[model samples]
Structure formats: structure tokens, C-alpha cells
Target: MRRLFPALLAVAAALAAAFLLLPLVALFARVSPGTLVVRAGQGAFRDALVVSLKTSLIAHAIVLGVGTPAAYLLATRRFRGRSLLVGVLELPLVLPPAVAGISLLAAFGANGLLGGTLDALGLRIPFTQAAVVLAVVFVASPFYLRAAIAAFEAVDPRLLEASRTLGAGPGRTFARVALPLAAGGLAAGSSLAWARGLGEFGATLMFAGSLRGVTQTLPLAIYAELNVDYPVALAIGALLVLVSVAVLLVIRLVPSWTRFASIWPTASAASSSR
Candidate 1:
């Protein structure tokens, strides 16, 4: 029975892998290199790719700038309502993209809660490039924040204490000790956030209106092309798949690279002492 159970699990795993890979295999099989090249040269494809890259990069910057410190605070501090705060921040991680879009609309749309104030200041958010960036940041920031908090928490408290003992202040200790040790995890989180931002669709389409060259990211472009130009859609989908695979590989490789970097100096020092 035990042997049979293991065999059954292996078969199930293989089936799962095949299920996931088959669609991607078929997609690439249908998209020839010549078709991809032709689509890539089109203005619409170029615009969508450019917008996607630009907005996602901006969103990634926002995530890193804001999420890193916020994560550190969450990791090291134990204040009242901390759990509630974390839950609220992480809500977007599980929230449907459509719901996220609606929430943004309620907050930032014309006649929305803050719309009057924004209008007075001449700052419109909905149906613009900025809205696209906001949607990406809204959905993707949680991934980086959660990962960053875990990474910071994983760092040794002793190291922080030692840095403090050496006359480093809190900020200095965090900068020198915590960040270095947690860098690999941060990199992985950033990659995840970037990938998520790059692929964002529902929220962007709803809040940003899918305006070509303004809010039409790669995913939106794919949707626009699906019925009108199926070949272009397939080509863009293949590009997204390749980018996603590369990001996943980077996420998988970063920790090993960090580990090797940490080990090399110690080994060199040991050899010198010997």
C-alpha cells in the first residue's frame, strides 16, 4: 500500500505538470518566429510593450521605496493592531483584480470619494497612464511587502545587536546588516512584483480604460488583439510567457547566488589564516 501510494502521488504530480505545460507548449507551437518578429515591429505592439515596461518599472520602484521600510517595521516591531494592519495590507494579495479595480474607481474615479478634491487640484487619476501605474502598484505591492517582511524577520537578531554594540545606530544597523542579509529575498520579491505588475489586466483595464499608447499594457494589448488580430495576440502572449519564465528563474537562482557570495569571503579568510 505504501509503495502504491508513492506511485500514485508521482503520477498525479506528472499529470499536474503536463496540464500546466501543454497550453504553453501549444501556444508557442502555433506562433512561428516570423510571425513574432512581424508583430513585434508593429506600432501597437511596440506601444503596449513600452507602456508595460514603463509602468511596471515605475510600480516596482514604488514598491521597493515604500515596501522595504514598511516591511522592516513590521518585522521588528510589535505594536497594538499590528496583526490587523498586516491583514489589511495583505488583503490585496487575495482580492480579485476586478474588486481592486472597483475599489480604485470608488476612491479615484470621477465623482468618487476624493474626486471632488482631486478635481479642485486638477489631478485626475482614472483612465490615465497614472491610473495604470496605480493599478499595478496596488495589486503587486503586497507580494513584495509580504516577501520583504518575511526576509527581514529571517535575519538574525544577534547580528543587529552586534552592529548596535559597535556603535551603529538603528538606521545604520538596518542599512548595513538587515538589508545585506535580506537582499536575495528582496530581489526575489521585486521580481515577483515586477512580473505581477507586468501582467496586470483587470484592474488596469477597468481603471485605466485600455487607451492605446497610454494605458494599454501588454496584457491589455493581448486582449484587444485576441479577436481582431489573433496572431498578434499569440505573439505577445509568447513574449509574456518568456518574460515570466525568466523572472521565475531569477527568483529561483537569487538565494543560491546570495549564499555563495556569503560563503566565499569566509572561505577566503580561512585560507588566508591557514
Candidate 2:
């Protein structure tokens, strides 16, 4: 019975892998390496690529700065409505991108929930690069925070106590002890956040609009190309596939990163013993 189950599981996995990868294989097969190079060099493709990279990177920075703290707070403390807060933080992950767009628009639009307040302050947010960043952050940050909270929670409380007993201040202990122990997990989570942000589409389009050289990111351009040009769409799709593969590879590479991060402290402890 056990042997049969293993064999059945293997068959299922193989079927799933084939189902997912066959389309990608066909798409890549359609593009010769030469055509890829040509498209990559074209101004529109290159510009879109640059915009995607910039916005995704900025979104990632925002996540790391904001989500990391939020995760830490969730991990280390218990308080009223903590779980509720976590739910709210992760709500975007479940939202349809178009709904998320409308939600943002209603909250921060020119006449939105907070629009009056923002208008009073003479600050503009919608239909801009900042809006793109906001949309990306909205859809992408939860993936990071969830992973990060798990990571921080896994750190040994004893180690933190030891640092405190040895006269480390709260900030020093966090920087010198907690952060090093958790860096690999944080890196893995951050990479995933970046990947999610990079692939963002509907929200960005609705909130930021598809203004070329202003708000037209690669995903936006890909959507635009699908209506008018198939080859351009294919080319953009190919580039996105490449970047997605790279980021997914990094996410899978976390085990190695954890192994490496574990090595340094072990080495130092061994040296002290010697």
C-alpha cells in the first residue's frame, strides 16, 4: 500500500509539472535566442524592463523597511487585536487585483475616503509613479511579512536573553544578534516580495494608468502589447519568465542561505572552544 502511494504521488507530481511547464516550453521554443536579443535591445522593451526593475526594487525597499518592523512586532509581542491586524495586513493577498485597484482609488483617489484630507494638504497620489509603488506594495508586502514573522518567531528566545544579560541594549541585541540569525529568512522573504511586486498588473494599470515612459512598467507594456502586437507580447512574456525564474530560484535557494548563515556562528563557537 505504501509503495503504491509513493508511486501515485510521483505520477501526480509529474503530471502537474508537465501541465505547468509545457506552455513555457512552447513559448520559449517559438523565440530563437537571436530574436530575444533583438527584442531586448529595442527601446520600448528596454524602457519597460527598466521601469519594471525600478518600481519592483522600490516596492521591495518599502516592504523591507515597513514589513520587517511589522513582522517583528507581531513575532515578539502579544496584544489586543494582533491577529486581526495580521488579517488586515494580509487582506490584499486575497483580493482580486482589480478590486484592490478600486479599493485604493476609493481610499486615496482625488475624491476618495482620504482624498479630501490629501487634497487639503495639496498632495497628489493617484496616477503617478508613487501610485504604482503603492499598488505594488499593497499586493506584494504580505508575502514578505508572513514569511518574515515566521522567521523572527523561529529565533531562540534564550539567545536574545543571553545578549541582554551580557549588557547589550535592545537595539544592539536586535542588530548584532537577532538580525544576523534571521537574515537568511528575511532575504528569502524579501526576494519573494520583489517577485510578486514585479509581476503586478491590474492594480497598477487601474491606479497608475498606462502612460509610456511614466507609468508603463513591463507588465503594463505586456498587457498593452497583447491588444495590438503579439510578438511584442511574447518578447515581454519571455523577459518576465526569465526574471520570474531567477527570483523563484532564489526563493528555493533559501535552504542553502540558511545553511551558510548557520556556519558562521558555529565556526565562531568552535574557535572559542579551541
Q: After superposing candidate 1 on the true structure, give the runs of residues whose Cα lies further than 4 Å from its correct spot.
A: 1-7, 263-274
lDDT of 1 by residue, 30-136 (tens): 99878888888797788999999899998888989999999999998999999999999999999999999999999999889999999999999999999999999
Instruction: Tell me how candidate 2 scores on lDDT.
Output: 0.86
If scored against the real structure, what TM-score would every candidate get?
Answer: 0.92, 0.89
Please list the C-alpha lDDT of all candidates, in the order they appear. Answer: 0.92, 0.86
lDDT of 2 by residue, 1-274 (tens): 7699999999999999999999999889877778888987776777788778788888888899988877988988899999999899889889999999999999999989999999899888999888999999999999999989988888888888999999999788888887877787888888888888989999999899888777889888888878787787788888789888998888888758668656446646878999
Q: In candidate 2, how many Å is residue 265 off?
A: 7.9
Model 2 CA lDDT for position 257 = 68
* Model 2 clashing-pair count: 0
